[model samples]
Every structure is written in C-alpha cells, then in structure tokens.
Target chain A: MTSEPLVLGIETSCDETGVGIVRGGTLLADAVASSLDEHARFGGVVPEVASRAHLEAMVPALERASREAGVRLDDVDAVAVTSGPGLAGALLVGVASAKALALGLGKPLFGVNHLAAHVAVDTLEHGPLPQPCIALLVSGGHSSLLLVEDVTQTVTPLGATIDDAAGEAFDKVARLLGLPFPGGPYVDRAARTGDPAYVVFPRGLTSPRDLERHRFDFSFSGLKTAVARWVETREREGQPVPVDDVAAAFQEAVCDVLVRKALDACRTHGVNDLLIGGGVAANSRLRAMAEERCGAAGVRVRVPRPKLCTDNGAMVAALGAQMVARGRTPSGLDLLADSSMPVTVVAR
Target chain B: MLLLAFDTATPAVTVALHDGRSVLATSTIVDAMRHGELLAPGIATVLREAGADRSDLTGIAVGVGPGPFTGLRVGLVTARTLGHVLDIPVHGVCTLDVLAAAAEVDEGQVGSFLVATDARRKEVYWARYSDRRTRVDGPHVSRPAEVATPDVVVGRGATLYPDAFPNAAGPLDPSAADLARLVATGSVPVLEPVPLYLRRPDVAEPTARKSVLTAR
Candidate 1:
C-alpha cells in the first residue's frame, strides 16, 4: 500500500497565519498565529496590518507546525496554500510562501480556494463527506450556501448574502452593544442570559414576498440598520436600553434566518446532509439552531469543531490531501492569488 | 555562489540568477497589477535560462521596498519563504539603491542624483544618492512639487512629473541584476527582511470606546 501523502498547508488569507501538516486523512499538526489582537483596537481587521503580521508570523508558524507534527520540512510530499477570496496582501503572503516551499523542496504546489477549504475541513473530522451535502459558509468576509457534490470537485453555489455578511452584521451590532472587535463570540455569550422574545428583530429575506424572489439569498444590512435605529430611538426617548435583550433578539433573528435558508436549500436540492463552516459557524447559537432545525427537518448536520471552523491551515492541508488522493492536477508554478476567486473553482 | 533575486516593489517584476561574480540570467517585465501572477513564472524562466535547478540556489535576495504595500510584500514574503525553506540567508536590499546602482553603471559617472519611483496618490518615493552609488538620504514619500530638484533625476517618478523634475532622465525601474549585484558586491547593508513602509498605514484605530449605557 502506498503511504499517505504528507502535505504542508499555509493560510494567511486574513489575520491568522496558520501552518498545518497532514498525512493523508490524519492531522499531524495545526498551528495558528493570529493577528486578531493587533486588529482588535481597530474594531476590524486592517489589511496592511494583517499583511505585516503574516510576514512576521509565517516562518515561526511553519517551524512550530513542523515541530508539532514531528515531521521535518524535507519530508513533506507537497505544499498547499489558500490562494484567494481574501485580503489581497494577506493572500499574497501565503501564496508567495507556498511557492517558495514548492520551489525549494521540489514539491508539487496546490493553490486551493479559501471557501472550499472551509467546506473540505469537515472531511478531516467527519470522515469522507456525504456527496451532495449542502454547506453553509458564514464568516466576516462571506456568507453563502454551497451544494457540494464532492468537496474536492464540484461545489455549486445555492445562495449568498446580498448585503453585509453574517459575521459583519454581528461585529457591527456588537459594536453598538459595546462588545469586542470580533463580536460573534461576545454576542453569542451576551445572548445566553437574555430573552429572545424581548423585541422581535426582523428576520432578513424571510418575508413571503422576499421568499418568492430571493428565497436562498440573504440581506443583513437592513437588519443592522434596524438595530441601530432601534438603539438610537431608545436613546432619543431617554430609555435605558436592555442590552442583553437586544443581543438575544438580534442573535435569534440572524440564526433563525440562516438556519431556515440553509435547510430550505437542503430540501430543495434533496440533499440529506448539511454542513456548516467558516468563522460564524463557531457561534454557539448558530450551531445549536442548525442542529435543532436540521434534526427536525430530517437533515443530518455536520460541523467541525469550532477550532476547525475558523480560518486555519489544516483545512487547506485536508483539501490538498484530498486533491492528491483523487489524482487532481497540481497548480502550476505561476498560480496567482485571486482575491475574488469564486467558490466554484476549488483550485487554480 | 548561486543566488536568486527578485523584485516586485515597482510596476515591474524582475528576476535574476547569478554567480558570485556575474549574473547568469535576468528578466524584467513591466506588469503593473500582475506581480503575484508573473513572479513565480518569471523566477522559473530565469532559473531555466541560467541552466540551474531551483535546488542549486544557495541564497536568495529580494527588494524590501518603500513601494506600495501590496506589490512590495509579494517579493519580501517570497524571499523570506525561500530562505526559511532552503535554510539559506535571504538578503534584503533597498529598492531605491538598486536603481541608483543601475544608474551609476549606466552613466559611468554619477554625481548627487535623486532616485524616485511612483508612490501613487501623486506622491513620489524619493531617495538621494551620492556619486559612489551610496544612498545619501531620504526614502521618503512626498508630493512631486515639494521635492528638491536635483542635478540629475532617475526613475519613473521623475518622468511622471516632468515639470517638477525638468532635469529628469528617462524612465528607470529597479532591475533584478542590480539586486543580485548588490548582494554580490556587499556594498549595501543587508538588514532583516522587513518591509520599509516609511509612511504610516492608512487605517486608524478607534479613538474612544463607545459607551454601552446611556447617560439618561
């Protein structure tokens, strides 16, 4: 039997510089160096700051990953990297680093898509993916439902956010609530003790009229505006805002809409399995709601652990291992980091 | 000593392969927005032209630019990665110095001249250099109109604002051969491969924390 291919993956698509090593289906190392603290004061990631941080963290992350994996750099069979759908400067850092490794070690290079990697990461945890699974990818930068016939091959776009991404809305609303920079987890925590029915926040794109047209598509900008207006009006009336209630209501609305639409896509496509990935998948509310709703809908739900949901190199390595096992062609040396690379193209 | 050098700080992407004494091969392409796409292929081409395998490279050199943040990071990251993977020392050279050395080589006699390159937003990245091809002062970004006119000016920045620099020579971009030569000659200080972003980043941090409670 052929030994499993050892792949080293690099991901600096955003604020995290991640490096991971995988031997076929088994994960050896997953090391992440986040610049989240640097971006915290800014309330959002500054692209230039993230880029600078990646340059500093990349070498160290690689070293750590190799050491953790107990694999020497020379032993890795191939290199994989996230090529796009991220900050251009950030993506370039990982891409350049991947290229150098591929060139230096004389290994094959795989430039994988960031979004698809999110979906592919589940395979590492849940064994091989059930074909024709509906994947809901929610993060600060993107929110989309993808129909995956094969994580390594075809991923069909079902619907996506027409306005602000789900995580962006969380961050903005969290700011209004005086929460932290990356507001998802904070908002999730704040919502725990509050009443979800205190105020009925609008569930975006769920109106009967919207369902007829944009049933799968999402729009959160209006919901964000509504939250802001509600807060401002309470301030104008000199009423003390019930921050906990507001957090709970907002989280309920967002999760309700997300889970509703994701299950709808699964039903429409006749897919029995649903997978949720990306940073927003780390939200406790989203996970619980998705599991409950999908359970009732007779759709099996698959979500990697929270650590795997966020941006990491292990996902890229998993996808790369899949590509190699399936005999997919490796990317040429001239591969470019495409910031707006669509989710359909898994590799470039 | 087999060396591989590249620069993507300017609009052009340059790559070169060199021995200690002479450049074995070099290629430069003026591609404004495609540095990420062009650079790896350019390196492969140069290495092939020089009849050297990628594994044969003993060291890597790259331009640590005072250029646009996006383009400049590509070369630096690439150099650093190569160095880390190959276990070789990566040398970082000021891109402006490469242009100055090129100018000196081209003109044979170089007095005090300014090396300027496009910094976008109508500003130029300018540095003063002496006749010995040494960087005298300023890897600064300034409005072309505010820059002190020099006896001779080199680079795309001088050509762009002709009225500001009337004595400006024709266009010049940093070359890969010069980047390789800088490492070969040991004329310039080889600093840690950190980006020379002379200006503060555009994004600002939040000034004051928002109040969670209303004063009322």
Candidate 2:
C-alpha cells in the first residue's frame, strides 16, 4: 500500500506451508507450518499428503504472516508463490492460494521459480547481490549449479546431479547408520567428534574423465553405494561399523566435492562471489568448507542464515521484491505451477 | 450478501456469483489437467460479468470433494484464502449434495436415488439420498457394480458407467451456481473447510529392510 512494495509469498513446493511478507528489501514476517512430522513416518515426502497439508495450513500461515508483520492482508502490494520444480500437487496448492489472494486483493501475482528464490534470499542478508555470481544450490530434490546474472531476470543453468541429490544421499547414508529420517542435521551433529579420515570415500565426478563431460555436474548415488558396500563388508567380517566415523567420512566426501566444484565454478566464470543456498547449505561442514575454501580463493561465500537456507516463504518474497523493484511484468492469473520450472525463468 | 462459489472436485473448474437473491453470473471450464490454471481466471470472468470485484464478496462457498485430492485441494485452498482476505464466512458444501440439489430443481425427478461422481482408480464416489434434501446412505467409494442400483442416478459417474446407471439423469456435473444456491438456502449440511477424502493417502511405514548393519 505504501511506496515500497509489500509482498506476500506462499511456498508449498514441499512439506512446508510457508507464508512470508516482505516490505521492499527488508523481510517483515516469515510464518512456516511444516508437515515434516507427517512425512517423517513415511521416510520421505508423499505428494498427496503434502498437498492436503498445504491446504490445511495455507490459511493459517497467511494469517500468521500478516499478523507477525503487523499489517493487514489488504496492505500487500503484490503476491508471490513458488510455482515450480517441486511435487506437482504440492505446487498447485500454493499456486492456487497465491492466485486467489492476488485476485481477491486486486494485486499483481508473481509465480517464481523455487531455485531462484533460494539464490535471491541471500540478498536479504547481504545487501544486493554482486552480479555474475556462481551459486551452488543443494537440497533434498535437487543439486543444481546456477549462474546468476540477475535474480529477477537472468539465471543460466550450469549443471545438476546426474543421479541422487546431496541431501538425499545424506538421508540414505543416515538410514544405513540407523539415524532418523531427514538426517542432514543429525549427520552433521554425529560427524563432529568422529574422524574424517576413518574411511576413504570416493569424491564423485572429480576425475578427469568425468570433468571432461560433466565439469559442474554432481554424482552422489555411486558414493552412496560405495558407503553401503563398505559398511556391509565391515559387518560381514564381524567388525562393528562405527556409525560416527562413517558419518564423518561420508559428510566429508560430499562437502569436499561441493566446495571444490563451487570454487572451481567461481574461478572458471571469473566471478568474485560464491553463494551457497538450499537445505544442504545449513550443513555445518558444507558451510565451513565453503567459507574456508572461498576464503583461500578470495571469492567470498555468501549464505543466508540457516532459517533462510531451507525452504521457506521469505526466499520467494525476496525474489518477488526484486521483481517489483526491477519493474518486471507480473505473471497472469493463469500462471501454471510447472513442477519442472527451470531456474532460467526466475519469475514466471 | 454477495456470495462467490466454486468447485474443482472434478475436471470442471466452476465459478458463480450470487448477490444474496439470485445467481448473477456463472462459468464452468471442463479441463481435467488445468484446474490450477483455470480456477482464478474462471472466478475473474464471473466477477467481471457480474460487474463486481472480489472485495465486493461477502461470503465464500466451495465444494469439499470426496473427489480427487489434488483438484479438490485447489478449490479449498482458494476458497479459504479468499474468505480470509475478505474476512468473510466460507461455507464448505458437499460436492455430491450440490449435484443432488441441481437434480431436484432442473430435472424435478427424484426419490431415493443416488448421486455419483468419478472417483478414479475405476471407482465412483457415490451417496444415496432419500430425496434431494436428505442423504440416506453412502458418500462411499467403490466400483460401479458394488454400488446399490437405484432407479435414478445423477452426476458424471452416470455417464461413466452406462450399464449400471441406466437411468442416468439430472446434471452431469455440479456447477458453482447450484453450490451457491445450496449454501444460500442452507439446504445441506455445512462441513469444515477440509477435504472429504474417503481414502487415506497411499503410503505405508517403511518395512524393516535388510540393512548392511544387520549383515552380521
């Protein structure tokens, strides 16, 4: 309602029903209601369950966001929603709610890409992003390398996982170690006191042959299989598989490859800043390694706080705020919730 | 009372505007896969036709389906949000009841009949009614052959199972206009703004897998 765009963002790309309100570059409120407990019993996210939870959580989250921001819904200047690269049904719930809010309030709607939102969230913490930065986005469903010329306008796809995502690999390895579902945080916790040199795990896609074809691409499925084989051999030989040591070793491999490639991309693109964003960005080792590696290489690593790193509405709002500031055209009410929406189309 | 109603329980994305007295305008676009894309635009068109805006709405009504989960959630999510923004009352009407209401008025032919809609997986979502106003049994999901054969049947399931529903009649789908009428008249039971999914989400607890740790 004011001169600065007051944006409301809805994110149902996965198990979280997140609603965030942002006034210009400053974040106002971030209200998130996660259905992670529901999916935890299933070992992973179920699309139908997630969709239903989003519907149940949508209205409440919206109210909470506006209340926290101390602003009425009518005060919002525009609405933003994560419209892609997620579960089909889950994305639809958010896209539908956002459309309705935009329609009801007579405001513009911005259907944004989930990946681009992750990259743009960084700008909220660290003032405007330096153009032409390399971003390594890692999460449960995706492990993509992106070149960001602008968050609102242009983003070039560099590479992605050839098989399993880094978070998914962490989950699978955690299960093998008898840890809980969504073991990214738990693995990070257990690996702290354990020895990283306990076992030598293969770093995926780092070999010269692999680099020739997939210089920026990642592969964790083979490493996951290698970890499984090693544990099985240890158990079969009547030796107890040390859970902590295995966690540390596995975590080290994933972090090493991620930091190594990210710094390499920064060097290759002649970009001075390296940004890490997504669920995996919250990992202690990934953060430390990126900071350490980028510090050595002189390409500053920018990662938003852990809350913004994982999926949430603030990220989407951050991207939407950029779109409004840049005077980008709003998407029509017929904005499609494309499950595979590419990062190239930042705001659809 | 300006009431806006919609249903995405089936492939048809329907919207209607009611100005407390009669139906002002209504639209239905039957596209199976475009529920998310078509719903807001459909509502926008109906509002434009009625020469009104979404802020002019006083109440919201939506079909909480014993229908598909994905499409059904679209309507509920939209309806709830619109209600929230407008600070209006949202009435959740049973989708089958809306079809039954339409059958009683338009066709005026019914007594102890069944209303069934397509429930996918080769099944139908059906409920029996003593008349248009009172449901007698069902709102259950089953194969067509498993449903009680009534002399009269209404809704899309009738078109889907011709042999079983020989007397398939009334409306093929529930429109937003009829849903609006039901909510306005208080003719049917108002439900919580949640899905009426008769089936649970298809998932199971992870069975004990033969883990490598157990290899010893």
Task: Please tell me which predicted candidate would have the highest TM-score against the true structure.
Answer: 2
* Model 1 lDDT tens row, A1-348: 979999999998999999989999888999999999988888999998999999899889999999999989999999999998899989998998898889888899999999999988888898888988999999999999999998887988888999999999999999988888899999999999989999899999998999998989999998888888788789778998888899999999999999999999998999999999999999998989998889998999999999999999999999999999999999998888889999889999
- CAPRI band of model 2? medium
lDDT tens digits, residue span B1-216, model 2:
889999999878999998878999999999888999999999999999999977788999999998888899899999998888888889898899988877743335445788999999989999988778788887899999887485688899988998788878868889999889888877789998888999999998888756544434
True contacts kept of each: 0.68, 0.91
Model 2 steric clash pairs: none
lDDT of 1 by residue, B119-154 (tens): 999999989877536788989999999985946888
Judge candidate 2 at residue A253 and give its lDDT.
Answer: 98
Top-lDDT structure, candidate number: 2
Q: Deviation in angstroms for A326 in model 1?
A: 0.7
Which window of 10 residues has the lowest lDDT sum in candidate 2 chain A? A1-10
The CA-based lDDT of model 1 is what? 0.89
Off by over 4 Å in 2: A1-3, B104-110, B148-150, B210-216
Could you tell me which residue pairs clash in candidate 1? none
For all candidates in order, the CA lDDT equals 0.89, 0.90
Q: iRMSD per model?
A: 3.4, 1.9
lDDT of 2 by residue, A235-344 (tens): 77899999999999999999999989888889999999988999999999999988888898899989999999999999999899989989999999999999999888
